[model samples]
Structure formats: structure tokens, C-alpha cells
Target: MNEQNDNAGLFGSGDEAPSNHSNNPHFNDLVAGITRRQILASSAALGSLAFLGATLPSLAEAGEQTVASQPLKRRNRLPFTAIPTSRADTISVPPGYKATPFIPWGTPITGRYPAFADDASNSAQDQAEQTGMHHDGMHFFPIDAQRGLGRQSDHGLLVLNHEYIDAPLLHPNGPTVVNGKRVNAEEVRKEINAHGVSVVEIRRNVRGEWDVVPSPRNRRITAATPMQIRGPARGHKLLQTRYSPDGKATRGTQNNCSNGYTPWGTYLTCEENWAGYFASADADMPRELSRYGLRSSSRFGWNTLPGDEFERFDATRKGASATADYRNEPNHFGWIVEIDPFNPESVPIKRTALGRFAHEGLIFAPAKAGRPLVCYSGDDSQNEYLYKYVSRDRYWPGFSHGRLLDEGTLYVARFNADGSGEWLALDITNPRFLKACLTARVTFADQGEVLINTRLAADVVGATKMDRPEWGAVHPDTGEVYFTLTNNTARTLADAANPRIANAYGHIIRWREQSRDHTGTRFNWDLFLLAGPQTDSRGPDGTALTADNTLASPDGLWFDPDGRLWIQTDMSGSQLSNGPFGNNHMLVADPRSGELKRFLVGPLGAEITGITATPDFRTLFVNIQHPGEGSTATNLLSSWPDGPGKRPRSSTVIITREDGRHIL
Candidate 1:
């Protein structure tokens, strides 16, 4: 989720500005109807309320309440001393903590465990058996289920998403091209093989050091792996590509960014910026393609080569029918893919009932035994909408499965000026939504078509255009949902939900469901914090941020077992310009007191992301992605984990306390 201006061409590049949400009602219009004094008064009144109370217990709390015949007690304060920000080309942690790099890119996990070559000489076949590149949202699934879910601290399967690739660092040289076309097929294949998810079995040895263990459970699901399409949009006419004429299946998952997990023990990897991988030469593209930012060219020139596998990247109508050419290839992407880490033989399923866009990630609300299963997600592009999905059937304790995700109602949010919001259903059966579509002259044949063009449907319903909504987290005790709106440079109007214009520095917003009901259509929200430098930023209490907590672009967010909010920053383009914030870092905040402290900082040219921990909360894992991002094969910007003269590869860092105490 790098929302920098330099990568604008690869993301939301088109004739229409990304901020332009068609002719529908703008967020500014909602704010203009209220007085400024009234808006400020409402914010000040809500600032004193405690986010967590004796409300409904969240699913996170329900699962962890009883660890070993004892109730899990929540910690009231942060234990570790806060570390200062840094610019050094290495990981920085507190004085009593140790950080070790583990299983970097090209580390073989399966088959004949091929070691990584520093010169990037590994073949595509070797890449299939190794860890993927640019590790992002991750989780640790304990193999010792005897201790129950999220209770084991010794062994587990480490599942993480490989968001994307840096071709210059991936190949012997950069991408090879002759006359503006890719000349090497192996290079393209290896790049494709590096774009999915990795499942590795890891354990702690006798020395208490965490290391990767070679096991049959180790596997890689790349862009060429077979996957099944499931949900309302599955087998639709729009999904009828040359590969899957019936549209019941697709080949792979790419651009997987953030992630989620189910109570049934399945992994959910989201597809972000997936539209950039496809190119359509047609001048007049369908609303489904145009609304999601598909263009005349792709991010990587995988479509420039010969062969059906390579030609699939070129989504043009040439054979006079949707099934003849790859015109509908783009429809196969932009989904929430589910994988069972425990079962290596199972096929990944793309759950389409959860409306598709640039899904940053998905977070489930607390699952009640007889209540409907509910989850929330966000579109990562500028001015996109936030969404919620509620299953049609009630949840059952041990009988829940992926089928629960197939039949559901998807809704987009609309924030009003008074801080109260409503969830507008995206279903065509809803009279209000259908009327809005008819008024806008947008027609949909069925719910499948409405979901396929989800962005356009959101636009027609007058949903609030948010500042790039990224990861979301639900409080274990309170069930309050928090989402990070990564900075949006294109925004010029102010709204109650997003109050800043030209919002270079983003903010965190949270909401509580009405009457403690997750299935309710209403919520009450407030701004948690405005992220920027000390002089301009505001904390939870509306005071200026201190030097110890100044930051920007809050990307990855998670709440530890004890209810500590861990925040990771992605200040990509602003790292050099923003002098006060030295580099990308991680912070810990007590939501009860609004006290925040800088905990860890990553190397230069890297974004700190993907965080998880052992069940005991003693061993924590964090990822450093794309170190020395702009470096080429010859000139290196950073050589992290390894010293100088070595390539800076994206690797996961394991953090542990010297005294062997809990992380909180």
C-alpha cells in the first residue's frame, strides 16, 4: 500500500482524476450542510469518551478469554521503554530487545531447498520452492492445536503475503527488453512466480532462537497456481476468460497485500493494486475496467512477450467474443483469496461475495455463536469506499466454513456531517440503491454485475469518498472498528470523517456499532489521531503531537492480545523531505490513555509492515519490505541484515525480550 505520487502511473492513472467520484454527491456537500462550529463542538464532545467499555465482547476476546483454564487479563500500561527514531540502515529496537532477520527472499522452503544466490541467478523453478518477495500481512498458525487456537508459543506455520516485486533486485540485471518488448521469458516467469503467498513451517529450537524448519507443510502459491472462484460473482459472464470459459475458476493471485484469518482456521489474502497488472488496448473500456484504474499498459511488461500465458496480460477483445480472447482476464483478480494453511492439498478460493476493489485487507468482527458473521474491508485507492459484509446465515460454533462467505449482503459506508454514519447496502434489490443506479443511467443485469463493478456501484450510491483506506482492526473487548486512511494528496474538500484537505499526513478513524450490534446499519465515529509532524499533528485528546510520537502514513495496524495498538508507518516519498520523522518505524499506543511511543524503526528505503506474535506474546515477528527500493543491480542504497556489499532483501525480523517477558 505505497500511496506515493511517483507510483501514480502504476496505480490510479487515467483520464479522470482518482479523486473524481463521478457526479454523485461529494463528501464536501455533506459537510457544507452543517456549520463549522457545530462540527467542532461534536468532535470535542466525543473526544472524552472511552473507546472500550462493557459492551459486546469482540471475536478476538471470545477466542482468547480462556487461555489455560484462566481468564486473560488485559495490561493497563506499556512495559518497555520507548526507542527514538533513526535513519541507520539496520533495525532499531529497545535496549532490552533483540531483532533477528529470518527467511529472506529466495530462501528455499520446499523441494531440493535451493540456497539464495546473491547475484540473482536463481531460476523460475527455484523461485517456486522458495520464499516469495516483498513480504506483507502475515500470521502464525500454531501446529500444537492441543493448546488451542492462538495459545501455542513453540511451533506454527508462518503464512505471509508477497505483495509485489522489485525487478532490478530480482534479476541478474533489470528486466531485459529489446525494441520495447521483454526478450527473456524466464525472467518474466520468475517475476510471476514471486508474486503470491508463502506457507513455511517455523519453530523455536532449544536455544530459544526462532528458525525455519524443513517440513512437508512448506509450500508456495504463486501467480500460476490453480484457484477456484466462489461466491455470487463466480461463473458470471464477465468472468468468462479464455482460461476459464465457464468462469468457475482462475489461475492465480497477485499483488496480495494485507491479510486476515477465520475462526475456522483459514487464511484470507487481499489483492491490492491488482488492476495495474492488466492492460487493455481498447479506447472505450467497460465501466468495470475503467472505474478500477485499468490502462493501456501494465505495471510490468509481462504482456509484451509471446505465448498465451504472457498474452493473457493483454486484456483486449480480438476474437469477437468474451471467451475467445482474454478481454475478461482482469475480472479474475481483485478478490479476497482464502487458503487453508493446514491443508496443502486444498485449492485457494476467491470469495467474491465480498465486493471487490483494491482490497487492502479484511478484519472480522467478534463472531457470536448464533449471530451473523460480519467483516469489514477497504479499497486502497484514493477516494475509494470502505465496505462491510454480513453473512446471510447465522454462525455456528464448529460447523462454520467458507460457505458462510458465499451468501452475504455487502454494504458501503456514508459518513454524515454530525459524526453519525449509515451503511448503504450495495445490493440491487435495495430500492434506494436501485433508484440511485437508475438515476445515474447505470444499469446492472444482476447482483453479480453490480458486484463486478463495485466501485461504480459505490459511486452511484453516493458513498463517502475516503482518503486511501488501508488496514482495519477491531478491539477485542469493545468491538470498536479502527481503520487507517493513508494520506491522499488529491483531496481538496473537507468532510467530518476526513477533515483535512490536501491530506499529506493521514489520520485514524474509528466507529462503534449502534447498540452493540454488529449487524446494525448505523454507527458513531470519531477521529482518533491526525498523523504528521509534532507541530501540525494532533493526538487523541486534540493536543499537538510530541516529538516522541510524530509520524505519518499509518499503513499496517493490529491489536495485541492485551489490547495494545501496534502501528506501522509507510512514509515512502516523504521519508527524505520530512526531516523530523527520520525513517519508517513502528509504534505502540495505549488506546485508553492515548499515550504513544516509538518502538522500532526499519532500515533506509524500506516500509515497516506485517506484524504477528507467538501466542504467549513473548516472541514477536515484523517485516521490513523493499529496503533500498530505488536501487539497481550496481548501486545499492542499503544492505540491511547483511552488512555492506550485499543486496538488501525484504526479510522478516523476530523480536524477543532479553528477560523473556511478555511483549506488552
Candidate 2:
């Protein structure tokens, strides 16, 4: 998903396109390959991307990123260009800051065990005992400063999400396959443990140091961890699996993408692009079949492995109906999970109040003491829909919220062709839903059912479909929410959300709430960014359509502490080696002026993701995920931070302004 934009983070996969993969093709609609006579004149003008390997590497290697390794003009200095963009192997930060590999795959998060044993064959239980990777979106909770812990104390909690797995290099001999099949149940158990979230307590010393503080509160949630399923789907026949016969609960959270934190103190981890892993065989799992958009087994063929653990993707209960067969297991996943990070003793819960899709991230509006709480999300797929949820109860300050989260209405966004939009509530209370379900004989006993089956309900209401929506961040100064609309491969002009014929570059669209009311139905919106070549695909459209303004596939997005919006890229296709842009890089934008420029570019074969700023606005943390991602550990395509000879590793970089100045 990082390679494209549908799923913004490096962990997940995207949903299927409606008709085609992408809406726009590079040139004019004309497909002319004429004879020698016709070849005399030019047919179409084409644009180029600056992502080619040979040219990019040669240019980057010639320059140096060792700017941080030497002395500086300022005493408490910051490295201006300490890290250069390269296809090398390592993460980079400012000269004054250091990036330690705090956590990696299979590392223990509880701080109870020694470092992970190299080549260790850990089990599902052991996995539940360790920290998971690739660590995607994270937030630092100040336990001492704000949570009433202690004033002026530099210590707090770290809440993070483990998005998904990096399968190839996970095992010693590559997942122990027996005759083209997965090796053992033990391997499957190890993988299950790697898929959830981690919450740990960290503290800083008077010397300004940061380290983990081992406490009983430190905990982990793995594949087999016990989670409470709270939604309409709970106890539904479709969710009944061999593991949970009653279907009231399930195992773990998979493909967790971007995350959000409620003002009331709960973690929202989204499940995105989850359907790709399942294999719904026609004859074996008719209950799991969905001819409209249902897919076959995963491309990785993990189900073919030689054990039952590898067979969960089969999606059949071996019984008669949905209840009999446990065929609806896939439904249990693909929903947003809410975890009480501070309450380590309590189990994490999945809030079905939010409609399901390829959930990229969940961002909430600033809570007013008596106002209805609201949140927004994007379905990370080509030509998907933007969504919002309104809490049924006003947010209660302090630590008073317990069951109110379960009672809410979910809605999908509909952007009008005239630039206005509406949030259609998908609740049983609506006349349309009540009448439709009654006529169709689909019984809905309570609000829980409505929240659980949110997608179907939204479809009945009709919401405006949008380009692939990714990670989103709200502008603290303006209260406007900005979300990344990664390119829709099947982008077409027939839809209002996508007006242009060839939406090659994609865009970042934002909207401001009317009077800052989260429950208000109407709001004003605008096109904050238009991505592509900033030139043209060669048509009647103005060259203004595709020029320096044009940049393909906007992905990771976040608002820095100072309110500056940082935009990152995920260029795939012909753009990489043959494109015009130098390489995938992170850019900074003045949201007030729309004046944007490249702040830092990344090396080849890497996606810049998960950016956050320190509370004081003096420091920034950015993730360099999956460097040389396409390369095997043996082949070694990219050298990256250290260059070719060293091993490629994923790490976080701390960016600070040079001269110790405030970053604008």
C-alpha cells in the first residue's frame, strides 16, 4: 500500500478498484501505432518521472549526508542536511539528535527479557510476549506532564501500532515451507503474535535522556490476545469461527494501518486492506463467496503452508449455512479496533461504531465539554469513500468514559459537484434505513447491528465516492482536516469526487467545520493540493494541470507542532527510474499560504511515513519504512543509510532545524 497510496502506511494492502485499476493513462486517449508513413509526425507528448535507479543513485552518491558527523557553527547545533536521500541502508536524523533502534521485529516490549535471540523460533505465546513490527504510526503520551503524573517531569507513555508483517525475511529459511506449503503451526503462531499493538512506559532523566521504564503496566497484544468485540457484528453468525464458535469474539487485529487517539484517552487502530490474504474457494467455501468483489487466496500463498494455522484464510466452516460453516470469519476482521492504552489490565475492544473499509487512520476533532464528539476516516483504496462518525453522547472530560463509545452513529462523506458536501448518517433511526431493512426482511434488533454492518447501510444511503484516501491530520490553528487522496489507478472523470479526466497525480483535499461544530451536517471544503506532473498527460487541458505543481501519489501526511503540514510521496510505475521528480521525498507546506517545498527527499525503494513533532516543536520524528523493500536480504538492491555493503534496516529519524531555530 505504501508503494501506491490506497493504504498509506507500509503495513497494509488496498481494496479492489471499481472497474479498472487507474482512471487515467499517461497520454491522450488516442492509441495510434501507425505504419512508417504515420510515424513521421509526433503522435503524443509524454511526461517523465525522476525515479530511475541508475540516474538517481549516481546523483545522490555524488553528494554527502555526513553533514551531522562533524562540527557545526552553533554550539547546540542541528544538522541542516545531516541525512541525504539515498537507496542506502539506515535511518538519518539531525546532527544533534540520535535515532536508536528502540524496537524491531520480535523484540520484547515488556523489558522483561534479554534482547531477541537471533534466529529464534518464537511461538504465538512468545510473540504475544514481544514487541511487533513494522512500527507505523505512534504518539508519545506525557504521563507526568498532562496525565496528572507529575509536573515538569520528562516521562510518559508510548502508544504505538504494529501495522503488519514483512514475511520474506521473518524466518531463517523463509517461513519453513514443506513442498511449496507453509512449514508448521509453530511458525503460524509466531506470526499471529506479531500483528497487534504495544503500549510501554518511557522516562527521561535530568540529563535529558529517554529510556523505557519497566513497569507492570507495560503490555503487548498479539494475534492470539483476548480482545472484546463490541459492535453489531458481535455474536453474528458470520463471525463464528472454529476458534470462537459462538462468534462473540475473535483472535487478533491484522493489517493495522494509521492510528488515532481520542481526547478522552483511547487508541484507535484501523484495519485496512485485509481481504487480500483470504482465499475463498468456490466449492469449499460458498458461504465466504462474494462474486461482486470477493478474491482468491493471498498472492503469498500462506494458506498452502502445511498446517491448520495456515488454513484460516480458507474461510469455510465445513457446515451448512453462515452459522454452520464459520465462513464469515473474514467479517470479524476489517473493523476498527479501540484499545485503552492506559488500562493495561483491560482487554482491547473493537468499536463497530465506525464503518468498515480499508481504514487508513482515525482522527478525532477537538472535544468540546458539551458538544457531540466527532471523528473522520478515509477508505484507503482507489476511488473509495471518505467517512465520519458522530458519538451519540457528548465527550466527558477526565477518565469518566467507559461504555459511551459503543453508542454512536457512523456516516460516509458525499462531496457534491459544486464543491459542497454532506455527512449521511447510517443509523437505524433514519427513516430510509428502517423502511429499507423492513421491506427486505433484514431484521435489525438494535443500534449494535447498524454499527456492525455499516458498509451495507452506507450504500443504501448513497455517499460520494472519492479517490484513494490515506492518512489525515487536522490543523490545530484552523480546525481544518487535511487528508491524502493517493492516486486512484482507475481514476475517471465520470465521478464528482474525481472531476478531472486523468487524475494521475491525485490531490489533498480539506474541509473546515461550520462554526467548529463536530455534529453539524454541512461544511465548506477546498482543494488544498493537486498532485501529478504539474504538466499534462497531453490533452486539451492546460499545462497548468501538470507542472512543478504536479507530483504523483501523495501518501503519508501529518501536521507538525507548529501547524506546518508535511507531505510525503509513494511513486510507483514508470516514475521511479524514468520519472521527473528526483526521488520519493517529504515536503513541507505552509497551510495558510499553500507555499510548499521539498523539505527532505528519501532514498530509492523507500516510503517516507509516520511523521510527528515533539510537544515543544523543537524536534520531529519521521519513519523510513521498508528501505530496499523490494530487494531480498540475499540480493540486496539498495544500500540506503550506510550504502550497499551494509544491511538495510527500518528506523525512525529525528529532524530538527539547524541553528536550533524554530522550524516553520
lDDT winner among the candidates? 1
lDDT of each: 0.83, 0.59
lDDT per residue as tens, model 1, 182-255? 77999999999998999999989999988788898899999989999999998999999888999998988999
**Which residue runs of candidate 1 sit more than 4 Å off their true CA positions?**
3-20, 25-29, 32-76, 145-150, 494-500
* lDDT agreement of model 1 with the native: 0.83
Using all chains and alpha carbons, the TM-scores for the candidates as numbered come to 0.93, 0.79
Residue 442 of model 1 has an lDDT of: 88
Q: How close is candidate 1 to the true structure, as a TM-score?
A: 0.93
lDDT of 2 by residue, 113-206 (tens): 4455444445556667677756667666667433322332356666666766655445544466555455566666676667777776766557
Q: Give the Å error, residue 247, model 2.
A: 3.0
Q: Each candidate's root-mean-square deviation in Å?
A: 4.4, 10.6
